[model samples]
Target: MQAAPTPVLLSSTPIDLSPWLSALDSVSAAIGDIPALLSLAVEAGRTWPQPGGGRTVVLWELLASVSAIDVAAARVLEPHLDAVAILSQSAQAFPDIRPGAEGAGDEAWGVFAAEAPGTRLEARSAGTGTVISGTKPWCSLAGSLDSAVITANTDDGGRAAFAVSLRHPGVTCEQPEWIARGLREIPSGSVHFEHVPAVPLGGTGWYHSRPGFAWGGMGVAACWLGGAVGVARDFRTGLSAGAEGGREPDQVSLAALGEVDRTLTAVLQYLARVAARMDDGTLGSGAGQSTWSEAQRVRGTVAAAVERVLTLVGSNRGPGPLAFDERYAKRMADLALYVRQHHGARDDAQLGRLALKGDCPW
Candidate 1:
């Protein structure tokens, strides 16, 4: 008998992500149920956007959707989304590997490319294949993901990417390394690859130097912006519904609300422009702004927007929402953890250096 064909995943275009959004809401409100979380991940995988016109559209929509629900869930989902985006670009970068280019399935994907000095994952050439051995930290969904796009040091002292299966015989994932109360569901830890067989993805310097790599970094900002929006919703809802308890919101509270709206609006517009530029292929070297500089610039801007939203929400709403509303509290905490992906003053300094060289492509 012939095997059954894999069903086609839904196109995220004409994007209606209500089901997954609802799932996220349920998971966030409830105290982090593992089964529910897995179900949501599956939904996300199935609807993961393919490379096309609506890619960035689906990205912003999904980030906002997940952020509006819960950031921990966003944390779980973002890496998978990033992995897909990375692999999608890698396919073009190294067409010879024929890496799987399909959307979400039972086999989830993550990107594990964090580098540790003196502990690089060396790729050993074996016949027409390669094997990776070393420790990779900051690996999200380490044990859970079926496959991933990992980076390794090639024998020639250059870097290369590999598609490695987690279930391979020599692989071992270190559990419970991610002990933070926020984003606790995302098991970001270390994974040990001991002679794990793999398929090479791209050549030396390709993974970091690619234009899409920077574009993908900016995609992360979209998720952070969405999470901030999610947290700000509590403030919006509460202020509009009257003040905490029964008191009317004062001028101070109203001012805070204004700032929240302005911050989110600016960040949202910036994200839209960046996404459009990315889709139109105008976010590159000759476009007057290198993708790397553009990504850093936007990431920094969105990161600041996230801070402003959090500050405004906290100061305006006070602690009532944080103490009483479980969802609001979780989102606030989650957003706090997620935005730390930005490097703060260091990133700002890098942008300053880039600006001194030439005009930035915004």
Candidate 2:
């Protein structure tokens, strides 16, 4: 029989895929259902934005997509983490899959699906004159990842990014001993590197130098939205039970659930509107401002509101080991911590710029 050709993936332009790479880095055993995405495809996660266009909603679109990717990656790597050569092949798999982030930092990229916050990932100069190393936190799929998109202070004092495999020399992983309570599934550890060979990305600070990087940076809202949605679903389960038998639900629980529904809805709408604008390129300069307000910066507002609902139900829903019972309590902890995962200080600065008069205030 003739040899069969392997199918190849192709796209028109080079894109920054660090976002999705971040997703691949997050999948793990904790990832709920890997095949569920295929059987019950999520409309929101399927279509990512292309250069000039994409999906209609903005909130956590990337994060949600990545979260899904985590599920997929988990399906592939969780059982194989103990395999040695498996890690090498895993690193090789990433450069091909996330082709869009060809030149991203090695910190964000991972060769395997597993790793650490300060995991050192380095490569010998293929004599390609490349060197890479650095520290990266939030490496969700650290122990399983194959490589990393890293940033470091270069020899000349400027910053640089490169791709490196964890199996390479000089790479080390600093696993976070304690994982955050909420979003407990995302295993963001650490990575570190020392004199690792690397292929330099375009230049230093490439993380934010590109256009739309701001829009690209904080799309983590979608994952937040997913967890929020999950929380709401869990809450709804509680509410339905609490309202069972027409026994008159408690007023405080009812009221709290209502507010959680209301606030999350508003935030999701904000995400949808801004995302549409971004897709059509119709978003004005202030788009960043609006997105920040809804998607992040003030994400604490959503977090706080969600917290209110969870606390209300957890404390009053009548304890047990059922799904809507004690399990819901865990999600409460997850959301509480997960909600605060974004770059709050930076988002605050952006929001601050709009609130106060600055030299280039919007």
Candidate 3:
């Protein structure tokens, strides 16, 4: 079946993402298969536009398109693309860091940067290089992916990013007994690094300080937006089917659909504006408070919009689809868990603080 057309960002130069949509559609049925998803991510990493490049909009659109197909695919693909972007930024910032030449081959990569209490990954100088040791938590697909751009604390009390091979003898990936119903195929388990050799990507505290960090966060919002779109699509499909069956949607359902369309349209426009700003350097490259505030705003807005979409979809469609349609049910569950990455009220409070400090654009 032909893939549904991807939403085009409002740009002076129109980009044709139909090819990517078609490619993702070909493997839509194998959504939960790790190998197939990894293969697609590798292919996309080879040709997809890097965030903050001139084609930032295209990069996000591709992410959203993948999410629209399956949230699990986005779960696997977003971090891979983010890893590529991080490596690219690192290479630009540090002359000695060569992405491909630094033992980071053309294999599938993930970003394992999440840290947990009482668990730490330390990066220490080992002769002319560095090695990371300890446990890194929330490492999604760590066992399956070939490499990762992980963050580890340094001896100087600062954190830095390193590209390390997951297949090394010093590395141990724990089997995840993940009980989460959503994103069941993609397990986020911890990996222990026993002095695993690593190539430093950038200088101290450069991973989270880079401007691309905010851009990457916004890219995740794009995935949320896309997943919501997928849910909204199911609602639309149900409405159309009902109409064809001579059971037209009532005023309440039509109003819910209208609200969904309005919310998605507003978020899409906001994302386009942010992407353009990022590409044109209007968002600044210093990872300033303003950049972070904008990212927080985008994430919070998208998260709220997604929540509304899920609610509308549930209320309008009732429990029939949730109970019977496996794909739709999975989409709903995956998106609910995925958008929680936004941190909801905590993020809103951060934004509130930023606004009070005059960091936000109002």
TM-scores of the models, in the given order?
Answer: 0.86, 0.62, 0.95
Q: State the lDDT of candidate 1 residue by residue for 65-123, as single tens digits.
A: 66566677666666666766667677776676757655335666788888756566888
Clashes of each: 0, 57, 0
- Among the numbered candidates, top lDDT falls to 3
**Window of ten residues with lowest summed lDDT in model 2:** 5-14
* Candidate 1: clashing pairs of residues: none
Error of 2 at 19 (Å): 22
The lDDT per prediction is 0.72, 0.45, 0.86
- In candidate 3, which residue pairs clash? none
Look at candidate 2 and tell me the lDDT of residue 72.
30
Task: TM-score for candidate 2, please give it.
Answer: 0.62
Model 3 residue 100 CA deviation in Å? 4.1
Q: Write the per-residue lDDT of candidate 3 for residues 1-362, one digit (tens) a residue.
A: 65454553534233376546566664476688999888888878878899878988888887887788899999998998899888888888886765565433469999988988989999999998888999999999898999999999999999999989999999999998899989999999899999899988888988888888998999999999989998998899999999999999999999999999999989998999989998898884433346888899989999999999999889889999999999999999999999989888889999888778777654
Off by over 4 Å in 1: 1-31, 34-39, 50-54, 100-105, 243-246, 285-288
- Stretches of candidate 3 exceeding 4 Å from the true structure: 1-15, 99-104, 284-289
Q: Which one wins by TM-score: 1 or 3?
A: 3
Residue 331, model 1, lDDT:
82
